[model samples]
Target: MEALKEVYSRSFFEQFVKVVKREYPPFDKNRFFELIYDQAWPDRELKMRIRHVADVLTQTLPPTYEEALGILMRIAPGCRGFEYLFLADFVELNGLSYYENSIKALEMFTVCASAEFAVRPFILKDPDRMMAQMLAWSTHQNEHLRRLASEGCRPRLPWGVSLQMFKADPGPILPILDNLKQDSSEYVRKSVANNLNDISKDHPELVLDISKRWYGHHPHTDWIVRHACRSLLKQGNPDALGLFGLGNAEGIDVRQLVTSTPQLKVGEDLIFSFHIQNLSNDARKLRIEYEIGFVKKNGSLSSKRFKLSEKMYPPGTSSVSKKHSFKPITTRVYYAGQHKLSVIINGREAALVPFDLMDGNP
Candidate 1:
């Protein structure tokens, strides 16, 4: 697979230069190319390349911030995609001092490509003013702008700078979320859910309160509440589980829990099977999950939970079988050692089983 940074290749820049030249005839395409392909270009990563492009634009575009932004706006609609995020990055890198113009530019550019990453610096510079603007954007006619209202203020927006102030006290963000809780677009609603999810990491109680109030009000709101409380649910928060009627495992049983292999190897699958019974007479909601105590570098265990099933179980037994692969992936390293797996029903651990992992054959 090609590195994402390769999207800013010479081919992309050729098209980019043509559009910019069409809008602003004086655009220094020669100088732009020269600077863009400088000594440090090849080594720069995706974000670094974006910032580099934004920096190059600073030199090739008009000297004044507003003038450069105007040219960008004219060419923005012609440019689109994740690759074109640099359009917004230009405003973030150069237009911080020009608040009114930068804010307007971000709004316009977001229509072509999201300004989610661009708007955070303004939020940091003037929380009160930027948040007021975000509140106004919450009701914007453009769904992109409405989505930006929630996405831009995310405390821990991935690949974007974290907003410490909002993470510390997300009071201002709540009003924006409230206004957008029932937005018409799923794109906008997903951002609202993500914003709430980010908030939940720091202020679980606050999110729980909001989830409780919004759960049954509207279908959209219900979806948002459930998604927003995912982290809390994963942690077995009683309040979070109760919202979905997934209560404690009072009348559940785990039987015949065993693994296919006495010992396993990396890049192999660990096949396991078990039986679950609802011992009670009445139907009960059961969230069946598995926990893996992965062996760490220092011989300690890092526990991770994965959901298997979540539904109502009647007074009977059901056989279950599943397999988990230990494929080599960039994100996690598999350590060769003794490991354990367990069944968790409704947030309660039911059965314990141990397995050994050996290094895969080279």
Candidate 2:
């Protein structure tokens, strides 16, 4: 304990150590001190020193996500660009409080969009809170908060939420979509579109339900529906196909597309698969595309599209397959929500496979 105090020596870790030493010091003294975590209190000199620590620690990264979580929690929000590093550190840590903090601090963050962008994996670990906040965020007066609602609920978030878990439940984000279906802000509305796109992965009917109704109520809904079902509209997914009225209207038709599992852990890959067949007595040229969406720690959804698979297939094919792999570099939980794998033909909707996932921390 005394040795740690001496080593802290007016550093960021010093302040925390001073406080902890006076109260309840750690028993794992030698090894714990070895885990260098300098605080960043927003001071010019100290901030530079803090950055140095971050650099040094980067090489000796935590062996497990749990250890990284604790190191980030102690940062004082000071130092030079410590916040980002702090976030990256949390990614390494996979911290619980990091998720909550990301939510609470979303408004304060200048990079709210990016922070919102970075929080999915942490939220994936705690969907209960993530879902609750997404619903509540929808009602917030601040556009950012409202944006968080729709953005966080998305089934596929670009560079954010893991897609595997989203294929499962996608239910938590429903209310947020309902609230933001007609949002005024283009930014927020775009998030809504992406959110819907994510949901379309697993719940094409639901996406269409909200989308069709949304289109009826507001003009903005058109953009959302179009963007949400981009992959579907491009090739041909049955649900998307039927919703958009692209293929044969009054013949033997394909069933609805559904995805299960709606949560994902960092460093994990989400595997999505679905059934497909042709009732027509001809070969189908299917162009399939899949996307991964995420729920930020602050209850926003961001989407990153991935090409799951695309090809020209013969009639009567039972299924198509694709997978998305991710390493959550932040303490963000990806709420497993609806996922969409859409099939299209010459820019027309044909079929869609919808599902959810649960892949975030482990």
Candidate 3:
């Protein structure tokens, strides 16, 4: 058999042992990492390991918040997805000074790599401050910070936070979004586009506003709009539904299905449904999709889109009340509005209806 030491570098393992020993003298590094890395059941051992790490941090660091924050920053490379939760708790519980001192470090990942669970609590607790900080961050010459402001708040940030509530209201965060919509950095602009795509779910109006406002202002902004609304256009939106000259030629019937909760909390299920019919007397290969508006902290709507289904429809046939389920995310806060949801069939046209996501047990 190969040596156990062959799997990882001697120095790396030594450092790992050193850090774990310092923080959790009793921790079994091998056992802990095995559980943390196990691909089977996710999200369980992660939290537990994170707790151990935090407890270690609590013990190993000096009492002063400054010292703790410094140590935390030094240890960022060790962050796993679950350890981030521990960090969030640490910040929320005792990191006023750390929060103040480590904006750069936090922004480093908050802009691009942070877990949504860790990200949302920060914004929920203090949105205005977060907005201001993000605004200033947007202005930074560092392409990273600029990208973070757009990426972190994106409604559909892949593998990052998905703030559907902000997808609805997006008011407080709108300025920061708008600021970066036309940013100079391509890296930042891409994040801006993805962010707009996320917002398109709950607030097509705002996305449209951005598209119209920036249309032809620059080739870059034009690119952003087209990308941001790709799904909408593909879904047969009259405006965004047809950039490729495909319009709603064949007439169709439509209806709204499930509406959102009257009041949606941070962690809840958002379900919606729609009824669609192909009227033409021929078998038609059509794609059906939807955009849902989420409420935001400032009582406005932001939007995000999801694909409902795609298939060929026989004449006089209708897929009615097809239901789709989604989970409300942490970053986006819901607000009350004449929340609109849209369904698109083929590349032909779109049908619209309105609903609400409210506070409920579910």
Candidate 4:
């Protein structure tokens, strides 16, 4: 597979220059290419390289923003792949002064690549005005634009600036989510769900209320509610669990819970086993999961839950065993200490076990 950095390669610049030259006859394709491929040009990272190309466009394109924007409008329709790189660059370059125009440009640019990160600065600068525009975009005929409308304003948008105001109080974004809740495109709906999920991190009750209010309205809306409540479900919040019919396991019995190793090094695996039996006479729905309480630097424990299985449990016994590797991963830092593990059935903790972690270093 080609590396992502290759997206801004010489060929990409050549294709982009070709498209620009078609609309702007005086576009100095050679000089533009030379500037982008200059010996000093840092092609080491994708984002930095994309910014370098944008800088070249600023130097080579028409001096005035409108003239350059007009040329971009023509060039944009023909641009493909990571062409949104240029559009996003344009937004970041001129968004403050040409906020309205940048919003319009992003509507076109997002269909090619996401403008979610591009629009965030404008939201942070003038949230009221920018979010008002986004609310209007929620009903846009273009699914990409509608998705951008919600995705851009996400409180915790990855790779984008955090919308802190929304994090403190997400009331302002609720209307935008409401407009797109029943959106025709799953793309738009998914963004709405993610936006809500971000809010759930800061304001759980607000998300739960929205989930309750929006439940059963439409099948698509139901999906949004479920996805929005994911974090709450992972934490085994009772309301969130009840909403998904994964409440307490009334007639369930957990037995034979054991760990393969009571102590292991960071690179080793921690295996476990368990058995569950349904005490109820009739069939019962169950959502089985496991939680691992990782020891943090402060001697406190932070738990992460993983889904094990979910199905109907007839009046019989079932056995399950699994292995979880504790290999070093970038996302988590393993500290040498005692950790806790628990079995969760229908959002109820049925068993708990402790294990010791050791650093491989001598």
Name the candidate that leads on lDDT: 1
> CA RMSD for every model?
1.8, 15.6, 12.0, 3.3
Put down candidate 4 lDDT per residue, 271-350, tens digits, no spaces: 99999988889787788899999999998999999998887778889898988899998689999899998999877899
Stretches of candidate 4 exceeding 4 Å from the true structure: 1-3, 25-49, 259-271, 294-302, 325-330, 333-340, 354-362
Per TM-score, the best of the predicted structures is 1
Model 1 lDDT tens row, 71-153:
89888888878888888999999888999888888998888878999999999999899999999999999999999999999
Off by over 4 Å in 1: none
Misplaced by over 4 Å in model 3 are 1-64, 75-98, 102-104, 108-119, 155-165, 243-245, 248-346, 349-362
TM-score of 3: 0.52
Candidates arranged by lDDT, highest first: 1, 4, 3, 2
lDDT of 2: 0.54
List model 3 lDDT by residue over 116-200, tens digit each.
3344556666777766777887888878677766666666566444565686687776788677767778877877787777777
Query: TM-scores of the models, in the given order?
Result: 0.94, 0.45, 0.52, 0.85
**What does the lDDT read for residue 330 in candidate 3?**
47
Candidate 1 TM-score versus the reference? 0.94
Q: List, residue by residue over 203-282, the lDDT tens digit for candidate 2.
A: 77777677666664567766667677775554445656555544443322334444443344445665655666666676
Better of 1 and 3 by TM-score: 1
Ten-residue region with minimum lDDT total, candidate 2: 1-10
Q: Say which prediction, candidate 2 or candidate 3, comes out ahead on TM-score.
A: 3
| TM-score between model 2 and native | 0.45
lDDT for residue 174 in candidate 2, whole number 0-100: 71
